[model samples]
Target: MLNTSEHPWKLVGPWYRPSSLGGYAVTKTALNRFSAPIIQKYADANFANNLVNEPQHSLRFNSEDFVQPFSGDPNQVITPIERAQSHTPLKLYLNTHSRFYVVVCELHCDVAGFPQVERNKVCEAGFVVRRRVPVITPELKGKVETLLQQRSQLQNDLNKVNMQVKTAQLQESQQSSDISGLLKTKSARLFSGLQSGTAEKLTEKLQDTNGQLDQLSQSGDIKIELQGWKSSDLKGVGNWLPIEETPEQITEQVIPMYPLIADPTNPNHSANGKTLWFGVIPTSLADVDSNNNPRFDDADLYEIRCFVRRHHSQFPIQKNHTDCCGDVIWSEATEGYQIAAHFDLDGTSHRPVNIKLPDLPAIRNQVNNAPAGRGASARIIAPAESSLNFATDSMDMPQGGEPLTRAGQQICFFSIFLFFIVAMFLFRLFLPILLFIFNLWFLLKLKFCIPPSFQFDAGLVGSLNFDGSFGADFNASIDAHVELMTEFTADLAVQVAIEGPDLEAKFNQPNFSITVNKGKDNEKTYVDEGVLANDLGLMIANGINASDDMRADIKNGGDSPGLSSLSLNELAGIFIAMQTEYQDVKHPELAGILPTPDSGLVYFEKVELNKEAA
Candidate 1:
């Protein structure tokens, strides 16, 4: 009985049939001989470096496709090759017999049209197509009818002959292996520890082993063992390994080495490009996988090889374990007698081409100034509890102090009170006059407030005096504003107190989120994602420029012209502005974003400015 489950047979994707099995074998053999050795060694090493080789993808508790959120959606489906990307089928029709009949393929079903027998054979690497068989021709239909009869007769004849050949061959190969093993046992006896009679017995066993070995080895079923057989009897033993045959290209493949999104204009279909394709998947390719699959500690079993388009044709790109790293591989099916020897991928890397945007007022700066009263009206934040940007969202930003969770806060507040008391006692005891003078000065400062036109020391803000004098201030009022005539520069400092170099430890939690919702109206009403580095730099630069102008004015006998006055609110606002402008200056857009810095990767048509840290 014909066991049809393991129906190993030739398959051509609506393309031409191979002329003979010889052609397919020969082409593939040549390719294997030429390329496997060179590539196999290095292919694995390169694959292991990918992030996909990490444990995250294979975690039993985690969904491997977690990176692709759509995987969980009921409507989402993985696309088949043809329609997954832009593709035009290299279409053809096959006639296994003189008359074309349907031949169902075991592995695929998109194609099923062929006649039985008629010496149907796949002789090339990919069955080569001669011409498209159009059904429009009328006389061709008549020929098909006659050819069907011939094919039916041939099929019956082949069925009868195939049974005897296959069964006998299977039994022979299976039996000869047993016989060869027996010979090996007997042959080993000659080398055993023994006396004269034992030696004679051993020699006898050796002779027996040799005789059986000769019989078994010379048989075609046991061709490999024929190496030890008599030279004359070894004839045609190695002939089971077929001779190479001519080949033709039946499909093309390509791979790109960067994150590629196949443009999906048709929303009705899953976003796997517009057309489906029919071609071989490189995931099954041993060249790429032999080294890649086994050695990686947590490697992905499958590598997606996309048949994408660049110059308006299909090519293959190997998606690295990360699914993002890689270069495009170009492949095409042709009638020429050649098969893919090896996939030669030129290493390619993608860096986003420099993007330039003008520096606008910072929403992030305003976001940063949530407590400092920049006003919520200046930002375009959606209704979200949190944001992905660590700097923008309050709950996510890093802060490294004991949490003031009710009880914890009470403990901390008490400790702070005790600390100040101890500090005052020590100061009063050790330096009585100094303590008295400091007390008297503070008393005077409160009793007789300095005019708005005068300046004071910079105030610090965050925790460890980062409020840039008042850098990280927890109590900055929403209604605070600085007089334009005083030296009240409120420099904002992102206080980072590290006992050592442990960022992951110190700021691991959301320490910077303390006063996020403090003053809603004081928040920014812009959608700008700008940060504060450049904007703060600008404020400092402007301060220097203004001071120079003031000195010039003072030299001309102007009233208090040399004075550089900045109120605390004005300083805070200016510092916020600088931080906003400096953060998003993508190296290429230095000037437009803020005061143009000379150092970086772009040659601006405008003059580059000398920069100093803000």
Candidate 2:
């Protein structure tokens, strides 16, 4: 225990958070900072200078002779601003890194007789900016430092739990592998059964190992890391599956309108997942025909079929479950369900196929979704279909034949002209209402784009080739196989995205809507709160800047102030509070070291301390 400081300073704290605009990857501890005047000066002069060095206003009149044109006494013309006057205006530069202080109720004396201190959680930090150092007041530093140390200690406990889970899995795998060896090596002796040994016992042991292996496979923790394999090194990989099953992971990912990083898998960067599928503008890509249409080849369609099935299977086929390809085989290896789809891309929901998943040898791997199910879902994980061939028909309003006007049971052309003039007046009065109705109809049609327009019959018509490997496009694979039912209906080619915990729908028009089902037993749909925020921000930011929201994005992308921009010292306070909250609200087992805070512990007098210490 440590002794309390004789005098304590009053201080405030602020915390740092990942700047929300760009999804900058930030850990809980890494936060922005702020401070009052005195502390803010210290940070600007010391911290920002260290990170980036440059003089301000030094080159005000570049080319020295320009000063000759203005020959007044400099002192008379310029009254020097007082330091206090300059500092009071609050020009704060948040030092992303700074610390705060806490109270030290306990003391341990070193050989020099000056006591070494433990942190004081109760002390007030009056650390101010503008004065030299943040007023750490010998005592506050002790407490803040101690709290930081304690937090480091607590995080270890959380890591240990994860490590324990990993270790247990490894041990189980080893035990099963050993049993498999025993069954193979000592088969004859084990089968003799003369000395209480029976084939059933061996079979039971084998089943146990197989079951263990199966459980481990579905454990969702087996992250198979692969070395970059060249064509030369593409030899048979061991019992481990092939890496060919991952590209579909990229397509299923939902990125918002934000720009994507090339090879975005690097751990250093954070990228948005729920992006619009039509992010690429119609004319922005490599090439388009005279009709401004891009091509989605038949080969791409076949390739997409193999992509979806190779990774997912066994999803529930209930109404609430994701709509998967009906013909694909279901297994634990592919953990998603299948559904029959029918797409009618002919400007009507008329053609429908018994949408079947063709067999592809790629059914080799499926990884678990991230923690709290952040990783993957069946809806967004479509089998890599290309949109190059999808048709983009223009929609024009219908025009009626010439009209006739009837007056007193006599229809005449001159009366028709008078009626037309009156009709124009009525149209002007109801134009907006008519537009609203049309837009509402289009939105409703977008919602049903998938089922009514995109399902196809996928049966082995007459001995189809079941071989899995083929060219990049599945065209050859389909060409080799034959389906008895040649007839099929096409509906709107809709897509879905399972981004993080949320799901969204993509219509052929490629506009987006929210997904309403999680395809789980409890029947939940992942809601997208970010999209709502994005939409509101777009409207608001657009109005504020008098330009497109994308322009606002460029202006604020790297320098956005985030939700809060406290002064440097204030940030330390915020982070401390956040860290404290993270500790306070953690599960009981997770909050082992921190004093169990409650109404009783809120006040100082209620806290019992070892006052007997010198």
TM-score (all chains, Cα) for each model? 0.16, 0.12
lDDT of 1 by residue, 8-110 (tens): 3222211111111011211221222111000000112222232122101110111111221112221122222212221112111111101111110111111
Best by lDDT: 1
Stretches > 4 Å off in candidate 2: 1-534, 542-602, 607-614
Residue 52 error, candidate 2, Å: 48
For 123-170, candidate 2 gives per-residue lDDT tens digits of: 111110001112234544575456435434433332333333333333
Q: Find the number of clashing residue pairs for candidate 1.
A: 83
Candidate 2 local Cα displacement, residue 111, angstroms: 15
| lDDT (Cα) of model 1 | 0.24
Q: Total clashes, candidate 2?
A: 88
